[model samples]
Target: MKKIPVYLFLFLLLAGCSLSNVQHNEELEDAIYLIVSDENNDKLSLNSMTTFDWDKAYLFTPYSTQESITEQLGVDFKDPSDIDWRDDIYLLVFLDSDQVIQYAELERQGADFSIGEKQYLTPTDDIINIKHD
Candidate 1:
């Protein structure tokens, strides 16, 4: 009846809202360029995954602490706010196929860094190697 139709409409509306709010992580294969930040706040552009040291890479979740990120990046911060993602941290920037820039905070592991929020680790050295122009 009318009550059933109203309930159905309300359910669809809520479902659509929730779906829209959910963020979808971009696939690594969709990324064209990987930009990394150095300790001096300098940026390095890696056009291909081959340039990245993958043997020492690992995957980490985004649920990390400010202290942990600071320690991993080998930077000192008296306050969490003192940590700048653009400079004081190791960030892995992914320029996706859709021209959308996605980023993840990186934690150094010896010679290589672990990417955060990435689900799987694949040998990407040979996949996409387009240099950023």
Candidate 2:
């Protein structure tokens, strides 16, 4: 009877550990972002881009332009048609203030590149723009 109780306790402890590991892996896979540049090869400014959410990922620069914010800190910019979904690179950006978190993935389809689904640390509405040089 004593051994039976011990075995049950061990089984429960192992199950809890496994569950934690799975959750940690999931978070790692979702924490990624990409950096986008402008025509002049300069990073876009974050002033023009919308604030980021800490819990969700964002597509920083969807298009290349000369007038848009050329530099951003938390946003991940990419060309939607140039990404390879199966072989996409993963990236993660930590906001300076610790308020916003960015994640990104690239997916390539035929002649087009697409960004994969992103997971942010927070909602989009909760992000505030931070200036950078």
Candidate 3:
């Protein structure tokens, strides 16, 4: 009947909505943070995952934080943000702690980064290690 078809369409549309209904903590199962090592090999803890600066990719540091750059690495593991650290530096992407690397590639923009998001991940492996790359 027409009533049945109309109800089905409405249900499908509502299900497809992309708006977030959960809090930030619920969105991220594990806290995300970045570990940065400066040119002098001084490691810094950038408590946020800031976006990559496509514009200043090579000019200077990508991340500018209100917190001092001298702040030591490693947070309490109960924080989340949208900032990351970059410059003439090396970056390590950690999920919860230094032991677990979310991005296992040695280099941040390594070749493994080219793999499709879904294809590069396995449900059974919480952490992935790329050896051949």
Candidate 4:
């Protein structure tokens, strides 16, 4: 009976330790604003969009620009002047204090987007709802 209680306590202790690993991505802890914009320059705030999958989104390295990110992803994105903003979308995540614009390219409409490392994907319904004016 004494051994049974000891083993049970050990199991609970180990379980708690494992649960510590399941946490929000530390990189996003200071995020204060998240917005999505279209080619038309229309903006929508996603700070209220609770269901967004932060796991599928990753921040680009600091000082990243459109040209640098395009080269990194091997994607031939259009020049800023050439792009028809009305047809496409971009997601921007801004951190606190400094207010840096974390660049995000919508790789495909209603599909997945890949940056240099992580894949950005949101539920199709969420995209549809947010894309509306």
Tell me the TM-score of each prediction against the true structure.
Answer: 0.22, 0.22, 0.19, 0.23
**Tens digit per residue, CA lDDT, model 1, 8-39:** 99999999785442122334323322332223
Which residue pairs in candidate 4 collide?
A: 39-85, 40-85
Query: The CA-based lDDT of model 2 is what?
Result: 0.33
Model 4 off-target regions past 4 Å?
A: 1-4, 31-133
Give lDDT per model, in order: 0.35, 0.33, 0.27, 0.36
Name the better of 2 and 3 by TM-score. 2
lDDT tens readout by residue for model 4, 54-115: 32222233234667545534444333322233234333332222222233333224322223
Candidate with top lDDT is 4
Model 1 residue pairs with clashes: none
TM-score of candidate 2 relative to the true fold: 0.22
Q: What is the lDDT of residue 110 in candidate 3?
A: 23
For model 2, how does the per-residue alpha-carbon lDDT over 71-127 read when each residue is reduced to its tens digit?
443333332233222233323333434333333332211212223343322333333
Clashes of each: 0, 37, 6, 2
Q: Which stretches of candidate 1 lie over 4 Å from their true place?
A: 1-4, 24-35, 39-133
Q: lDDT order of candidates, best first? A: 4, 1, 2, 3
Candidate 2 least-lDDT 10 residues: 30-39
